[model samples]
Target chain A: MLDVEGLAKATGAGGKEKIKIQRQITLPWVEAVRISVRNVTIRLGRTMITASGIVLGIAFLSSVWTSGVIQDGLQQARFEQERELVAATTRDQAKPDGGKTEDSAAVPGEEKQAQNSKRIWLVVMSLLVCGVGITNAMLMSVTERFREIGTMKCLGALDSFIVRLFLIEAIALGVLGSVLGTLLGHLAMLGIFALRERSLSVAAKMDWGQMLTYLLLCILIGTVLSLVSAIAPAVRAARMRPAVALQTEI
Target chain B: MAKIECPECGEQIETTGIVTVCPKCGADLREVMEAVGHERDERMKTIVRDDSVTTHEFIVRTRDLKKIYVMGEIEVPALRDVDLDVRRGEYLSIMGPSGSGKSTLFNMIGGLDKPTAGRCFIEEVDMAQLDAFELAWLRCRKIGYIFQTFNLIPVMTAMENITLPMIFAGMSTDEMMDRGRELLDMVGLGDRLDHKPYELSGGQQQRVAVARALANSPAIVLADEPTGNLDLHTGKEIIDLLKELNQASGVTVISATHDLKMIDVSDRVVHIRDGEIERIEHRADIDLEVGGMGEE
Candidate 1:
C-alpha cells in the first residue's frame, strides 16, 4: 500500500496530515546472498588475488596438521619395531646358553618434541602472514568500491546492509581459499610421506577423523580471519555520509 | 475519488469533483487555489494550505538549515541558514557557481546529510529526529537521486541498476523486473536493458540513471548537475526527457545545476551565492532570451 501513489498523496497534503502507513522494506536473505555472489563473480580476478593469501595460510596449516599425523604414524611403527626387538631378546635369554641381552630402546621423546615445536612455529608464521594479506586485500576492496558504496547509500541501502555485503563477500572467498589450501596441504603431505617412507600406505595408516577435523579447523580459521579483516573497512564505509561519498572522484 | 482539505477551515472533505466552497466555513477554496497559483486538477487536489495553521505548504521545508564541516582544527561552513520550500508537483532549480553550497542544500533536502544548526522537514517529518534506519526508509521511499556522474554500478546491467532501489525496498523479483522494464521503456532504453554502464554512451547512461531514479516512484527526484557531464546536444535531450517525465507524471523535481538550459525548464529558479540564497526567479519572470547571466 505504501507505493508511489501513497507517497504522492502524503507529500501533496503538504506535510500537515499524518498518513499511518508501514513503509519499511525488509531486504530478503536470498537477495543479499545473490548480490554478494554476483559481486564476487564480477570481480573474480581481484577476489582471487585477495584470496591467494588465505589459500597459502590454510595450505601451510594443512601441511602442519598432515605432518603431525605422519609423525604419529612413524612413532607407532618405531614402537612396534622396538617391541619386536625386545621380544627377540627375551626369547634369547630363555635359551639354554642364556645369551647376554642387548638393550633395544625406542628413540628419545625429546627429539620428537623438538620436531613438533618446529612444525608449530611454521604454522604460526603462516597464519600471521595470512592475516596480513587478508587485511590488506579487504582494505583495498573498500577503497576501490567507494563510489559504488556511495551510490548504494544514495539508493537507501542501510548501514547494516553494507556490513552484511562485505561480510558475505569475505565469507565466500574464505570458503573457497580454505578448500583449495586444504587440498594442496593434503597433496604436500602425501609427497612428504612418499619421500620419507617410499610408500603411500603411511597416509592410510593415519586417523581419518582427526585429519578431517584439522581441515575443518583450517576452514574455520580462514573464515574468521576474513571476517575480522573486513570489519574495519565495512564500518568505515557505512559511516560515510552520502554527500561526501558522492564527491569522491573514483 | 478526490480528497481535498479546506484551507480556511480545518476539515477533511471528500468530493467527486473540484469543490468551490468549504461546506463548513463557506470560504472560497477556489480563491485560495488562485492565490497559490494552483490549477484545478487532480495534481492540485491535496495542496491545501491554511495561513492560520502555519503548516508547511511545501513538500520539502527547511528552516535556518546550516552545515559546517570540521576538518582537524578548522571549521568549514558548507551551508548557511538555507530556508527553502519545494511545492508539490513543481520543478525547482537551484543555480549557483561551483562551491556556492547548492549541492549541499540538495543533499540536505535529499536526507543524505544532516544540518548543523537547523531543521529539515520532508512531508512534515523532522529529518534530524529520525534514526539511521528511519532516515534510510525516508531516503528509500521519499527521495530519488540522479547524480552528475551517472553513478551506475559498472558491473550491473541497466535493468539491474534500475531495480537496485526496488530490491532495497523489499519488492519481489517479479515486481522489480516489471517496474524496471517499464521504466526502461519510458526512458527509451528498452533494448538496452542488458547493457552494462561501460557499453552505453554517456547520454544513454544518464537516461538509465533517470529511469533508475524513478524506480521507487519517489515523491521528490533530486538531480545534481544531471547534464554536467553530457555534451550540448545530449544535455538538451536529457533535459527534454526530464521535462516530459515531469509533465507526464507530475512528480516534484529539484535540481542543482549551472546549465542555463536546465534552468529554463524549471518552474522557479533559486539563485544561491556564498552559501546563501540571493534571489528566486519564477518561470514568468525569467528572461530566456538573455542567454547567460550568472553562469560561471
Candidate 2:
C-alpha cells in the first residue's frame, strides 16, 4: 500500500511520522522489475562465465567441421579437374576411358579416401570437445548449487524434482549454445561457399532438422552429464541431515 | 477406500453414519439420506443448530513422535518420542546444541518431512492420514518456513521472493502483488522490495525472507537459526522484527536457535539435546544470560 517515493519523503523528513509514513510507502512494480532486471543481469553474467567454456568448445568443434567440409569440397573439385585433364590426355593418346582403367579409378578412390579421413578426424575431435564441455559445465553447475540442492531435498523436493531442475537448466544452456554455434558456423560455411561461386540455396543452408536433432542430443548429453555429475553430489546433498544442512555455511 | 480423513472437516473423522451434526459441536447440516430410506424415530433426528463452536483448536500437536535412521550399522534416532503442542498466537523457541532434532522437528511439523512413527496433528488434522496433495495444500496455507541462510530464491528480487507462496497457490497477478506488498510492509522491508538477496545486508535479506514466509499469512512460522549469518546488532534487529510480527498478527512462531538473546524474548523455549526434549521452560523464569553464544 505504501509508495517508494512516499517512503523516501518520509525517510528524508525523519519525523515521528516516519514510522507511519514508512508503513504507507509501497514499491512500484517498475522498481521490482528494475531490480529483477539487474539481478537477472548478474545471474546471466555468472551463467555466461560458466557456459563460456562449453560455448568455446562447441565453436571450435563446429569450425573444425566446417573446415573439414570445405576441405572435402576442395579435394573433390581438384579430383574432378584432374580426372578431366586425364580424360583429355587419354583421348588424345587413343587410350580407352574404362571403368576398369587403373588411372581413372585411382584418382576418384584417392579423393574419396581423403574425404573419409578428414570426416573421421573432424568427428573424433568434435566428440571429444563435446564430452569435455558437457562434463565441465555439469560439474560446475552441481558444485555451485550444492547447498541449494541439499536444501531443496530437505524441503521434500524429490529426486525426480531435482533431476528435472538440473535437466531443465542443461537444456536451456544447450539450446542457447547450439543456436549460437550453429549461426556462427553457418556464416563461416557461407563464406567458403561464396568463394566457390555456389549460390546460397535453402538446401545449402544449415539443416535445421540436423540442428534441432543435434540440439536435442546436446540437451540429452548435457542432462545425462549433469545427472551423472550431480548423482554423487545430489545424493550427498540429499543425505545431508537437515541439522547439518541448516548449519552449513552458505 | 482408506478412510484416513474426515469427509466434512478433513480431520481423521471417526464414527460412521451416526452424524446428526458434528458431534464435537452440534451444528445443523442438510441431513444425509439413508440408503435404505428407513424412517427414523423423531428423537434420532435431533439437530442442535446452536452448537457451532469448534472443539479442536490446537494449531499443532505432536504425540510421542519418532524418526529413526540407520547410517550403515548404527541406528540414529533423529527424534525420539517427542511430544509438543504449539497453540495459535504463541511464539515458542526450540533451542539446542548441534545434534539436536530441532530442524528435523520443524520439518516434520511443517509436513516437509514424514515422521517415522507416531502422530503429528495440525489444526486438529492428523498429518499421518493425508495424501501428498493434501499435505502440500496444508503446507501451502498453514505453515511458513524461514531457513538460516535466508532462502530467498537467489534469482529473484525481494518482491518476487515474497510472492512465491501465492504464486505456488495460483493467485492472480494483482492479488499476489498486493499481498506481497502487504507482507513487505509487515516485515518492514517496504523500501527494499526491488532489491535482490545479494544487494541486501544479512539482516535485510533475513527480513526479506521473513516477508516471503508470511506472504500467505500462515498460522505458523518455523524459523531455523534465522540470525546465524548476521552480526549481533543486526541479529537483534531481526529478532525484534520477528517478535513484532508475532505480537501484531497473532502468528505462532517456532524458532530453532542457539542465540540465547533470541531466547530472551521468546515466550517459551523448548530445549532439546541428543534428539530428546530436555525441558520446556517459560522465558519469564530463565535469565538466558548464563551462556555466551557465538553466531553460526
Query: Candidate 2: global Cα-lDDT?
Result: 0.62
Alpha-carbon interface RMSD for all candidates, in angstroms: 6.7, 17.4
Candidate RMSDs in order: 12.6, 19.6
TM-scores of the models, in the order given = 0.81, 0.67
Error of 2 at B231 (Å): 3.0
Error of 2 at A56 (Å): 4.5
What's the i-RMS for candidate 1 in angstroms? 6.7
* Model 1 pairs whose backbones collide: none
Give model 2's DockQ, 2 decimals.
0.05
lDDT string for model 2 (B41-134, tens) is: 1211221011212322345678789988778999899999998877566779999987788878887887766788987876656677665445
Candidate 2 regions off by >4 Å?
A1-42, A87-102, A114-118, A121-125, A149-165, A182-250, B1-55, B69-74, B283-296
lDDT of 1 by residue, B249-277 (tens): 66678999999997678888999998999
* Native contact fraction per model: 0.58, 0.03
